[model samples]
Target: MADRNPGMDLDLEWVSGVRVNTQAVLKRAQQVQGRKVAKKEWQAAWLLKAATCIDLTTLSGDDTPSNVHRLCMKAMQPIRYDLLQSMGMHDKDITTAAVCVYPSRVADAVKSLKAANSCIPVASVATGFPAGQTPLKTRLEEVRMAVEDGATEIDIVINRTLALTGQWAGLYEEIRQFREACGDAHMKTILAVGELGTFTNVYKASLVSMMAGSDFIKTSTGKESVNATYPVAIVMVRAIRDYYRKTDHKVGFKPAGGIRTAQEALVWLVLMKVELGDQWLTPHLFRLGASSLLGDIERQIYHYVTGRYPAYHELPMA
Candidate 1:
């Protein structure tokens, strides 16, 4: 694990001064998505690197212990052994960064990973996930319970009302409490960028979340109408770079939802490498949150080894 981000004091001046040029952000995002990606062996290798940073997630209402167990197994061995051996990476100990589930399923995920002797951390979404409309006491208790249930990381959703209303102090205090409730577990604060209304608001929310001690600033809860677009992500990472320059504290970034293909994953990796440099390229400072994204990544690997792509059922389902 990377060093924890012990948050700093809130600077309303810094938070309020944030301004994002929408047109400029869109142009930059286009350039990022337009860049040509590597092919053949290099593509295979970069896709494998993307696999290692995935937070293999199952956030469905119908998620069961059996499915969670299956998700855990897949996280342990994200790629087929033969596919890995074909690239001579079978012994690299490659696996998804972590297994993410709802707070109710944290125990089941922990049990499955433990029974299998896997060390991949269990992450649970708490604080009324997707919609953080719960009461303060209730949200705090939810965090504590998830931690006690063996969750090593907690993904908390910030109250968007504060951000939308420009209540910087209120937002800071709320996230600070969530950080405290996290205790030993790392906390990833979800900005739900799509709901923030404007790019400037997204940048301010990112700054405040980091000021309140969030280990990571995530793009969305994957439930929004718009999730994880490159323009929104660009604003968030720029805030991360700005924060790092000011406080010397490295905060991670996560772009969940709408990222479904190997090509999209490669684009995100490039976004991180180009915007935040090489250090943020690892799982320690970056993560991709998706349920079906891994399957396509695996399919791409299969195609790279073989001459063609395999049918959906050809690869094992998580």
Candidate 2:
């Protein structure tokens, strides 16, 4: 079973009261930008740390069992053997936090990980991923079905229409049922902030998702035009912080989509480090919803160890 969220019941008063000043939000985003990033051996250490926080993903119309198997293999041994040996981390079992895939591919991921004799978690994106326009019954069934198929974590997208129209109560109740259906599996609420209209909507949705018992509040579905911006993530993490203060439940955070580089990953790790502390830096509490990110992270690590950067093709997906 995954770590329990220990979330409180729907706190309508707190959810409705959530707010964010755009000007202040922009200023804070700017400040985070000005902070120095990890460099030298510290950069390599943070990169390895970032590897553990990655939810190595392969969600595509062309995703095949073969590809998912390859993804699982990558998750089990994210860094190259030579690099791990050189860094003296060969015995450390450095792997990505989790391997995420679609519902139909859940069994494939599980089979691959088990075959590797590894316990890395398999996360399935269900509840009509990237969009939850399916009927309520269908969505709930999706969650249960994914759980039955061996998904240890379920990343479900919020009904974007609800937040766009200011339907906080409806949104909260919907997520509450989804949480129950998850049972022992962790639930990550993807709030596709791009479609939520304003920062205030993003703030309210983040709080409501936490109130409704999301083990983690994710930023986007990764399918949106504008996914996972620094400013938006700051707003969501603040909501997580607020919820933790009120409920003592430490909910996780994931920023999916458009986050594709080592620099970008480090910046996000920096944000979480500054805002929430080291506790949020772990795989159990934070996960980067990414696919190409691992390759870049690998490339950077290779550069650090070999004094030469490998071409993008050197780090193939499969």
Candidate 3:
């Protein structure tokens, strides 16, 4: 279904107004010199919460079947097992919810996570992820294959060209088709906000993606020149929150790419907490699409739990 806007003039005016507001926010953010006001409290809370929510690792780039399988096994073993037990809890307590990987390795990830059953979802990046420069049919096929291969969640990239050109209709059509192809699988639409060039575009993309049937709206693919940033995430979350207020349809947010350190992840979590509130903090409403963030959070968790940091080399890599 097409979005219910009163008229073209109103749509254009609304977009233009948002653009003006976006500029003001950006200028204000740039002018601020000192640290963000709630930075400390937000960072501390995120570090603790991130440890429990993170699924620990991601595998990509020249990673073949054997190596990917090996990595999943390692995650299942000493890493997940030890992390859970150390928190004085079971598999249910620790946060790293699911393992994310390339589409080709969906089966391997599913097999590796079988022991946990549905406790952890297998997320696969589809639709020419990172680039998203492909035919709609091809992208839909990718989502279909991933679902067939047992991916519980499909993360597809939005057509950046359409989004940048203001072809909201074309972008919505693509997302609608992808959502249909996904069947029962959850769909996360990556906005690649860095490529969109402005907060207004990011906000519009978020609204359109959700309207088109995205269960979660994501920031980046972690493969672009610009990855996830706090300001960008704040814009997207604000859009989601507003959309929910108007329509009562809740959408989730995932900030992936370049979110490496515990501090960076915490910053995002803090932004979400303040914008979307505590209700959206759970795994269902939030996720960090990170590969190297786990080790950092694990280090923080170790310090908080045991009073000392473990040896750097001793920490496992996902």
Candidate 4:
């Protein structure tokens, strides 16, 4: 995906032409995940790759400084040191792609990572996350503040009202503003796809975000009644592929919220491979926005190597 690059100069015409047949897209989405399984050493390898692409997250109402700090510790080394040693991958750099937190807690995440001497990027959700019902100025400022707080990646929710109402151009300009506000930090535009009304709306929003120069077009904010469904993911990634074909710019894709098992991770890995090709397989261009997903993957890996189930204490804490 790196070779494809992230995005090119905005192309409005290409964005407008992107379309999807709802039934066909949904049919393929059903067929994509879990089509295959990697066992033994291969299973271990897939789990490792999934770990790299995870945006290890903790975006709860109960979030506190200590909770964020502990999450950072996990981000620095998602897999336990002894576990890595057992698989002979101890010396390999094995950390989650990034740590995601709310905008106000960006500084805490940054400080924790720095204190640990880890270069893992802190990603902050901004622009009035879950619902971008605020004014555009306020949302852009949120992105700015997060960037100022040392967030290397900023996940901003798009104005779903614009998308749901068929205001493609409005959505485009707003996301463009969010992208600009991010400056050096990569901007991930969360579509909150489930709220966007239809599959067509989801596809259009994805194109608009990419056209607006989003580094990654995400599926949902995870706060929606629905988030990261297979049909939605397939639609978004296909738009990404179309954008790449027309512009040779490969924007990343992130499916956040509700994905929580090792089998689920493997299914997504398979989806990326089958639909978007192996280039989209790495962390640079693909991310799973999840917290519990990691714990499940870790437990499964531990079982794979040790032939025994890991205890509750063996995993990352609640």
Candidate number achieving the greatest lDDT relative to the actual structure: 1
lDDT of 2 by residue, 27-105 (tens): 9988897899978899999999999999999999999989998899889889888898999999998999999999989
Q: Write down the TM-score of every candidate.
A: 0.99, 0.97, 0.85, 0.95
**Tens digits of lDDT, candidate 1, 257-309:** 88899999999999998899999999999999989999999999999999899
Residue 92 of candidate 2: its Cα lDDT? 95
Candidate 1, clashing residue pairs?
none
Model 1 Cα shift for residue 94 (angstroms): 0.7
lDDT of 3 by residue, 119-219 (tens): 46788999988799887788889999999999888889999999889888887778888888988888888998889987889988888887787888889
Worst 10 residues of 2 by lDDT: 1-10
Clashing residue pairs in candidate 2 are none
Clashes of each: 0, 0, 5, 0
lDDT of each: 0.95, 0.89, 0.72, 0.87
Instruction: For candidate 3, give the lDDT of residue 178.
Output: 87
Cα error, candidate 3, residue 43 (Å): 7.6
Q: Candidate 4's residue-wise lDDT over 167-191, tens digit each?
A: 7788877887787788878888899
What is the TM-score (0 to 1) of candidate 2? Answer: 0.97
Off by over 4 Å in 4: 1-18
Q: What clash pairs does model 3 have?
A: 52-95, 53-95, 53-96, 54-96, 55-96
